[model samples]
Target: MDDKKPLKRHEALKPLSRQHHFGLLFSWKLRKGFAGNISVNRLKAYADWFFVHEIEPHFKLEEDHIFPILGVRDALIVRALKEHRRIERLFHDQDNPKNSLSLLEEELEAHIRFEERVLFAEIQKVATQQELKKIEEIHFEIGSKEEYMDTFWEKN
Candidate 1:
């Protein structure tokens, strides 16, 4: 059993946390695609769309606005930056779609878990109210959900 208490996310970070939910869902879709024997090209296509529509913007927002709460020298931010680059490379890698997508699926999920459980907790603890207010403004930039109709992950 898990021993840790749940971390209460500050309102300023809620938008990113919400985005993390979508990220988790993205990983789930990948798992479904693999299990259903969906085509690598088809899975990669969805990953491409999600990378543009979700991951790219999310990473920028975190890098620009959120992660700065703890500053660049912090170990958590360093790890997060490394993870972001790894995930970005996975998304960009097209030569081996199956291997790349599988790695993407696992790495992305683990990265989200780390942010939610550790990095954000540290940020929330250290950020000043003024800093959080600046971070809170970022909610306006969170893009609305654009429907992707492929539904390859859904049961037929």
Candidate 2:
């Protein structure tokens, strides 16, 4: 049974939430790749591409605009920032690509869930209309719908 209060996301933050949706999909793809015995190097390559095309700019927007609404010292902001750093490290790990990818798969999903379920809720609760409007004005403009060439996650 679910008891958590339902959150209504402000229109301004919808773009970031949409990116969070993609982030969750990325995690699912990693899980599928691992379960299907796809090569670690191949998965790592996809992670690298995703970091550049998606996560980097998403992080930039959050750090630049969203986090400040709650201030850096807020516990939720601290945890969110730390998760971002840890996830970035997992994506960049070269020494144990397999282990890192496995961890990344789990951690990335958890991170997105955290943002969606908790942090964003708090932000919306506290953010003023002007702050949200400023966020909406920032123009996230994430990448197009172009597909990655590798289809390892797909069943042939």
Best by TM-score: 1
Q: Please report, as a residue range, the 10-residue window in candidate 2 with the lowest summed lDDT.
A: 138-147
For residues 1-156, write the lDDT of model 1, one tens digit per residue.
999787799998888898999999999999999999999999999999999999999999999988888998899999999999999999999789899999999999999999999999899889999999988775635654887778899963
Error of 1 at 80 (Å): 0.2
Name the lDDT of candidate 2: 0.91
**Clash list (residue pairs), candidate 1:** none
The per-prediction tally of clashing pairs is 0, 0
How well is each residue in 104-153 modelled by candidate 2, as lDDT tens digits? 98999999999998999899999999999999998886865678899888
Error of 2 at 19 (Å): 0.4
* Cα lDDT listed for each candidate: 0.91, 0.91
Which 10-residue window of candidate 1 scores lowest in summed lDDT? 136-145
Q: Model 2 misses residue 146 by how many Å?
A: 2.4
